[model samples]
Target: MRMYYPYVNAYRQNTPNDHNGSNQVMTVLGNGSVSVQPDVANVELGVITENVSLLEAQQANATTMNQVIEALLRFGVPRENIQTTSYTVNPRYDFVDGEQIFKGYQVSNMITVEITAIDQIGSILDAAVESGANQVNSIQFTVQNSDTYEQQALQEALANAYDKANAIATSMQVNLNPIPFRIEERTDTMPIPFSKLALSAEAGATPIEPGQIVIRATLEVKFRY
Candidate 1:
């Protein structure tokens, strides 16, 4: 006996074409970014180590670091600007005659200092060294409020996008500004959290250079004209 099947509506049909349709609406979404190496600034500081007995080493490092902090404070570095990056005690090893022995205890302390005065980077380093900072670990120059600069960049990017759109519109003999159906702002900083670059101030005066910051934005414009 023959069996009868229920009629399937074209709308409800689960055919391949219906389920996975691919007649894409040709829409152009271009992305552009503006980057400015804004003035680079950061905590120009260091870590000092004095290896003796662990206790003495700790005391010495503490004293020196305190002096450094004081000098920085005198140089106008605010209390809140100082960040204690690290502190630790490690055993120093001495190898002799094919034998390894404990030489002494090394005490190390690190503090991050944010110096806003770009002009005094050299003076600050000299002061830190004079104040007893020995082991210079890391010195980094970074933007204090990158967000503000980044926003400026974003605005520039939007303007760039507008420029591109207008150019395209002019080429097509149409005005995009009023003919666009909609203009949506697509903004971002690429990486959410920006990491500051680290440099060593052990050699030269803390290199405080104002470079540029990178920022970007995109706009999806439907220009009917």
Candidate 2:
């Protein structure tokens, strides 16, 4: 008896039956991907303030961040959608003549805002910046309902695996089982971040383009022939 095992891209492996008597098994890997427009966006923006005194720096950062949040709320963003992601105060230092000199305290406050209306990302970013937001960190795009797309991708992957296995069996003149004895799914869904954006708070109505998001699924199937 003989067995055939196929890896990625339909690479075949042949083995003579020595162990397991006359049992013959075939293994193959399949991959599928689906791309769709993102439905949601998360924007990370904040304010940074520096002052000689730590208390002053903290107070300034708090005031600016409050203004930014209020602006976002007035622009139709729900209060619950805005959440603080990071808040830190660190001492600033400078090297003068091979000596470390204390400069001031730097306070940074960052918030993540979730926007369901994808078209309004540019306007919202403009609003935040106009209201004392100085630091624009990043933006991430994702789909709200990912389970549906994942299932579709999985189905496509299984179909692909079946096709490959059938082709191998036909070429080798052997009987192939239509049903796989084992199926393993490897799926990964992640939010795509748009980091190459040219951002300028001073520029009017910053242009933001949200690209398509891709969901991928991989499967390893084993069949008896």
Candidate 3:
């Protein structure tokens, strides 16, 4: 009895055109993932203020934001790591009996802060809130750079493809030919899920845990036999 190549038939339609279109071409998918502790954390903090006048609202928001930035700086955060991400001023309105009424103006100022000192994350969050940060939009943990991890994943994926191709060829009693072409289906470093925190002085230091970040890559390999 001869072994039938079921895997080859499964992916026969997607075989590379440069190779033989018949049962000679086999396509296989290989995946690789690498996980490591996160090195940096990004936090988005915002200050919202409302007043009867637009100038007053904006001024109040700006003052609070300045205090927050100053606190972060005093905590050893670099100036370049602290940046204002967004600022907006909008009018507040109320609808009563199908009529629009102007209530007051609202100002929103948001900033993104990058922390390289992982151990200081909790302290930094506490300081920001104590200084006047009202809204904590999100906190994300990720690696500062992923080039090294990306290369490692690519190498692992390619090695996996090679081993799989050989194993299938031996099992089917066919001679595996050179690889004609391969495609990198996907490669990315994904950040951990972020959580929103309510900022208050009474809450004390915000506890932050930076977990591991996962880097993954997938490849489509075509082998001709």
Candidate 4:
């Protein structure tokens, strides 16, 4: 049987001129999407410190980062979920009379923390800041059970393709087959992180909103009718 993919010419262009079974074949593409609320979050926070010496700069950075990690642990974040992502120490220079002069040294240490609790995101960020986090970098929210959503979308896409095939078979006055040869195309959805959140005495908790996550599925179905 010949298949009629939308992007490919099944009868007029590719098949032989004497091909007579083209009327029995039908191809369809279906797209499906579902919206799901995020269940987990990953937040990156860090501390930046500057000192006259590299040792002092690194020491200060480590001290602040340790305090931040302790605070997160106290807030119920697991030790395994917290990881050091970046650490750097650089020399600060001052240009005077076109000469490079060393002024001080600056150190930066960053860690990524995974938060499973959906509702405590804001309060946790606030707590980290209180524990000496000065450079708040990024916060990302996503669904923990992505497999479930993707399966649901695939089912929906299959159903949509079947419906379209049925419609085409009916219009062509042919008997539709029960099963079709289907090719599934998978698409992954990315989480759009919330805008920057800064700490302030007046702002009670770091306001955060985890928007909906969308998953999509596509299928190419070929039916013999």
Candidate 5:
């Protein structure tokens, strides 16, 4: 019991033992958020499919896919981040008189690139186009990074909490101990998961935009006499 008292001392009226000299010490959490709707930027990088033969088709698709990756690398995109999101090597089926016939294997490899630089998006797309990446995917605006903004939001939440505590304490005619008796923060902000984040990679330049991203944080502080 005696040891736990120190935790609350910081908020109590200042005394010789409590260095916090009653400076309206009330525990509060403020909330803040920074957002910027990024300009549209994107380029779809994919392989073209042509069935010369089942094996030849696969080989050709792989070669073309590698060219696209090379183009991205040339544009300063990290090779590791460029991933093959889709791959398929299947025979094309044509039904004649309800009879299915295997024409040839349609092999294709499609990669998804996480473009970090907004400005380079257009250029990257252009490069993909020049590198024989003809199939354009979906594109749109979204947030690439949210950790910094999330921290900002947390600060704002703390401020809000402090204001609330002060108003309540003042209304009760209490000095609010000028500090927080108990400070608690609980937030479930999923930091930019791959699943939750995305920009359309549809065909035709995939006009993409990393629009404004919203980040929120909440804080709870309890003040005691």
Candidate 6:
């Protein structure tokens, strides 16, 4: 993250009347935002296997997860970008006539795949499901270089603050300093979620829309006249 320092002008000369001890300061709040399409997609997909025997369920889940990873690799995703997010083995049970009946063992293996190519998300989902991925957990779209956009937003916020302060000074018939003595930045970023995902292989090629992400910046500025 890049930090922005308070702006001070070297050419401005202060007189005795412009003493720092004077409480003649104007405070203003400014906001700025930028919207852009996300450059990266994170998809959480995995396999869930169930069997009467615990060993069989584990083996089945492992085999399916391996195949899914291989398919992702062949589809242009880097090996390092694919990571196992969770793996668990649990016993399945059912309530029959108020009696707990032991069903089987269920094994689930989930992995998160980072895709830099945003346009290939649909095809990637199809490939994963075809290769044995049965569960599609979530999909999130976000910017890869968020710092750059945040910096731009900060600059815009500062500009907005200066404009508001100058307008206020003009209305009060007082000279306003172009430079702000203090500035505080507050940034907020929210990732876009693609929640409507289908994991069935019969659904054919899935259509994915990354949409747009918004980067917002708020600044509190204090200026002296």
Q: Per-residue alpha-carbon lDDT of model 6 for 38-117, expressed as tens digits?
A: 99988898899999999999998988899999999998999999999999999999999999999999999989999998
CA lDDT of every candidate: 0.58, 0.83, 0.80, 0.77, 0.60, 0.85
**Model 5 CA lDDT for position 1:** 6
Q: For candidate 2, write residues 11-104 as lDDT tens digits.
A: 2345334322436889888778888799899999899999999999999899989999998998888999999999988999999999999999
| All models, RMSD in angstroms | 12.7, 6.5, 7.7, 6.7, 7.3, 2.7
**How does candidate 3 score on lDDT?**
0.80
Best by lDDT: 6
Report the CA-based lDDT of candidate 5 relative to the real structure. 0.60
- In model 3, the Cα lDDT at residue 39 comes to 90
At residue 50, what lDDT does model 2 achieve?
A: 99
Worst ten-residue run, lDDT, model 1?
Answer: 1-10
A best-first ranking of the candidates according to their lDDT comes to 6, 2, 3, 4, 5, 1
Using lDDT as the measure, name the better of candidate 3 and candidate 4. 3
Which regions of candidate 4 are displaced past 4 Å?
A: 1-26, 96-99, 167-178
As for candidate 3, its clashing pairs are: none
**Distance from true location, Cα of 109 in model 3, Å:** 0.7
Candidate 3 lDDT, 165-195, residue by residue in tens: 8799899987665453545456778898776
- TM-score, structure 1 vs. true: 0.61
Q: What is the lDDT of residue 33 in candidate 6?
A: 86
- What are the runs in model 5 whose C-alpha is more than 4 Å off? 1-30, 36-44, 48-52, 94-103, 134-148, 168-208, 220-225
- The estimated TM-scores of all candidates read 0.61, 0.87, 0.84, 0.79, 0.59, 0.88
Order of models, best TM-score first: 6, 2, 3, 4, 1, 5
